[model samples]
Target chain A: MSESNTIPKSLQEAIGTESKKLSNDIEKGAIRRFAEAIEDNNPLYVDENYAKSLGYRNVIAPPTFLRSVQTDPLPDHIKSPYSAVVDGGSVWEYFSPVCAGDIITTITTFENVFDRDGRLGNMIFLIKTTRYTNQLSELVATQTTTSITYEPKKEN
Target chain B: MNQNLYFEDIKEGMEIPTIKKNPTTQQLVKYAGASGDFYQIHYDMDYAKNNGLPGVILHGALKNAFLGQVITDWIGNSGKLKMLEVQYKGMDLPGTPVYAKGIVTDIIDENNINCDLWLETDKGDKTTVGKAIIQLPKK
Candidate 1:
């Protein structure tokens, strides 16, 4: 493959593929752990009464708490030869608050692929999106991630 | 842990209060476990070095959370973050000071506020840039 046309056929075939998964009921302990890890002191994220005071059913997760919602990786059939991967970044659109006790379900879609010449050489940007909905079927949030994959640097 | 920010009190050019973070390797470990992103490069020095990284680097999700804190801490409890977008431009390593900063870009509907946000290195390099839209409560 030429340097300009580096995105492999496997990744291209994976586009538009999707997988659905469920998250553990949003737990107070998990929320608090994430909050402490980030050093956030917002009571709304850990204190149930405080969240209720703000009209939430229970302690609400932080704005970025959706990071805790883990999902299955791509199927083995769509493997890329790249050895190292890093996050390119993320975009989020939140429609409603994700509070504790909410059992969330995520529908993740393998969305797009692009190749760019980056600082580390030609890197493939793999885009995927996950939509989260609560038990009530209310769409809570949607997040898209850009994962950058490239050849690993050999040990010197 | 201060006064609540209201839509009426914000100006287009207003600078939101900055939030600083000194992410330790331990915090990175905790974040990896909490976020389930144990991708080796974030906490494994040898793995990182083998992959051309100088050392273990901070996770982009952690940077995202940091920027999220900057916005939520400024908007107070009543405000809501409607949209947040982050682009990781450079790798931020552990133990370095990162400043999460933002400035109000526009005020729409007399309630919705749009802003440009970033995670800046000590030398003023924006390792990560983002945009945010927040809705502040009426005063």
Candidate 2:
């Protein structure tokens, strides 16, 4: 069966699933710090007035800022016998801008699993994708991350 | 501002001054708060281990943020950062410190100054290899 086929019939499956509704409790100061750290002075992020004038309640976080949010605690499927979690890289597809004070929920689906070879070693790749929705359940963003893990070399 | 650094000031093997940052669970939490992410692997320790991670790991974007700070600080306000790209290599766990530093690799002259940047981090069992392209101010 396909790994996506293995998403589990039950929500309680050891593999993590289920969506957590998000809140806007994130600190504006931290957002400012991140913008400064990135050297991004885009008015939407740094200037509250600018953001507000643009209809935001407060300063906006960078698109990549989504990386810092904490999700639900559960066993990840990549750890299962099928495969391991590797850092394959992530690609974020933006459908809309993320504004301050916007509560969001993310629905994550265990996408697929595969394998590959490299000069360093054998690798297992796990594909996971998440969809972010605002308070109204309106879809906001989709992020897909591919993780790769190295298995020990087999002796010939 | 500090004096402008150029290709002439650096050598291929030369290390840029090391910068240290200790990001706390609070920092990560704040990051999550701002970024609107709720991934359990970043905060729930048991969840991470159960998921096959040693513990809640640091966000890769945080590493890029650290590297961005290093370059912007070195270049000052006059220079604009044209672009930055990185491939996530590994995870960074909480409490364990992560260090980001780089070496000068190449110098490209395009009206503005640009350099090839390499970055790395060691946090307990996880070590990451990263690289970037940064534009610097011309003297």
Candidate 3:
């Protein structure tokens, strides 16, 4: 059974449902791993002393490090119908740096969904917006991520 | 290193320093672990090929980070990165060299500098395209 038909309705109904995900306390080890993964050797991301010298309280996460901190389950209604999911894009606004030991909470809400006919038959694009707040109740960052889901076109 | 890139020192059309990275298969595995996105296409070559990929591919978010580093490194200590928007346009394979490059596009309201950024593979394929805004300190 094709699942694409129901995607639009489900996504439309999910437009304003905000789900609060598990809070993550930024940790030094996690920051180090993320920096190494991206091959970024910036001392501000891994060296506490270096970060302190730069006026930061502790080692900070790379600008996009928050991408790795989400451990929450997506709201069922907004989950992609197709198995093949790819990142479409993201827009991030950084209000403050993410420092180690800073507990951050994320509130995710579905922003939009649309369909377009293409070479691949049909493509469904889902946009999810998340707001991150630090333990001090300060807005740290806001990210809008788009995910594209589609069925692969089979060669004839 | 104190880049000390004050607002007055930069001009439109100036190019930001480029940062190059070589993403290995092992690095992809580490990225999978750290990002909790254990998608087989990023770590398992066989699975990737079956899925129509050339081989273990670098994560899109990882590529985004590379562009972020380019802006942060160029802005130095006093500048604050305010916004970044990226579109993942192409896939990048592991073990390949990716270069992050940007050029200042506009100087908005004296403090905000908007730059266009992108990641290009050694073969000249653009994998990611984006824009960033930074607020630099006044000298």
The numbered model that scores best in DockQ is 3
Order the candidates by DockQ, highest first. 3, 1, 2
TM-score for predicted model 2 compared with the true structure: 0.53
Residue pairs in collision within model 3: none
Better of 2 and 3 by DockQ: 3
- Runs of candidate 3 with Cα error greater than 4 angstroms are A1-7
- Measured against the true structure, the TM-scores of the candidates, in listed sequence, are 0.91, 0.53, 0.93
Error of 2 at A6 (Å): 16
Give the DockQ-based CAPRI class for model 3.
Answer: high
| Candidate 2 residue-wise lDDT, A1-156, digit = tens | 334432233422433443444443455776677675444555656788966875667776665665654454224433534333445656555455566677766666666655556754556565667777776667766667777666444569
TM-score of chain A of each: 0.89, 0.72, 0.87
The residue pairs that clash in candidate 1, if any, are none
- Candidate 1 per-residue C-alpha lDDT over A14-130 given as tens digits, one digit per residue, 9 for 90 to 100: 898888576658898999999988888889888888789879999999888988886666666554468777777899999999998999988888899888886877788888899
